[model samples]
Target: MTLTHFTFCSAFILGLMGLTFHRTHLLSALLCLEGTMLSLYLASSLWSSSFVLSTTSITPMLILTFSACEAGTGLSLMVATARTYGNDKLHNLNLLQC
Candidate 1:
């Protein structure tokens, strides 16, 4: 199989694993999501012959930083929700209201 094919297949698997483990903890789920993103970045970079420093790579890096910010925001929201509700578990998160 070609390297690109392997890269995409592995990324898909990682994303699935992230979905599967998402119920365990909010932070863990976020990390798994990041792993999926990384796999996607790797796959995308493999598209060209030489993985040079170019605008294509720059966009994904920006996206990764954006995702990092998103994760921080999500964590803060999770903390606030848990503190207000007295539990951080995902099952208990449904009862929260704005």
Candidate 2:
């Protein structure tokens, strides 16, 4: 109901829409995936902050770390696709052909 929550939800939805509409470009999909992950991270952090518990949680850090790894992997895939196919179009990519 809060502004931050609304913003986070909007960002997440926009990222999903980007992924859906930009399915042709690998780079765009990667960027959208990162955006989705970032929004999830922000929302999780906000939710965690609402709990005034005795112990601290590292959920946000873990989410960030995994997102970074996912981004690196996606970038590597994009580079490989570009080098092999001359473009980053997902339609031209055929992993099963190899």
Candidate 3:
């Protein structure tokens, strides 16, 4: 409805598409995930601002903290995968074979 809403929605959709299209690379997927999280953070912050009755909602902070943790974990996984497989390709992360 509003410009902010449209912006956030489009950003989220673009991030989702990027994640899908870039699934072959671990780094790109992680970046897309981060972008999605950023859009979510912006949306949540905007929503929280409307609730003037309360001082402020902790949703934005919580999302930020979770995103940071997710980024750290994803980076570590990518680094480990690259070291183990010589490249960070998602297809190479197979666990079925012994």
* Steric overlap count per candidate: 0, 0, 0
TM-score of every prediction relative to native: 0.65, 0.88, 0.92
* Model 1 misplacement above 4 A: 48-55, 95-98
Residues 32-53 of candidate 3 have per-residue lDDT tens digits of 9999999999999999998874
Candidate 3 whole-model C-alpha lDDT, 0 to 1? 0.93
Candidate 3 residue runs with Cα over 4 Å from true position: 53-56
Backbone clash pairs for candidate 1 read none
User: Which candidate, 1 or 3, has the higher lDDT?
Assistant: 3
Predicted candidate 2, C-alpha RMSD:
1.9
TM-score of 3: 0.92
In order, what lDDT does every prediction score? 0.70, 0.90, 0.93
Clashing pairs in 2: none
lDDT of 1 by residue, 7-50 (tens): 68887697778768677566676667777767766665565326
Over all chains combined, what TM-score does candidate 2 have? 0.88
Candidate 2 deviant stretches above 4 angstroms? 54-56, 96-98
Q: Residue 52 in candidate 3 has what lDDT?
A: 72
Stronger candidate by TM-score (2 vs 3): 3
Best candidate (score: TM-score): 3
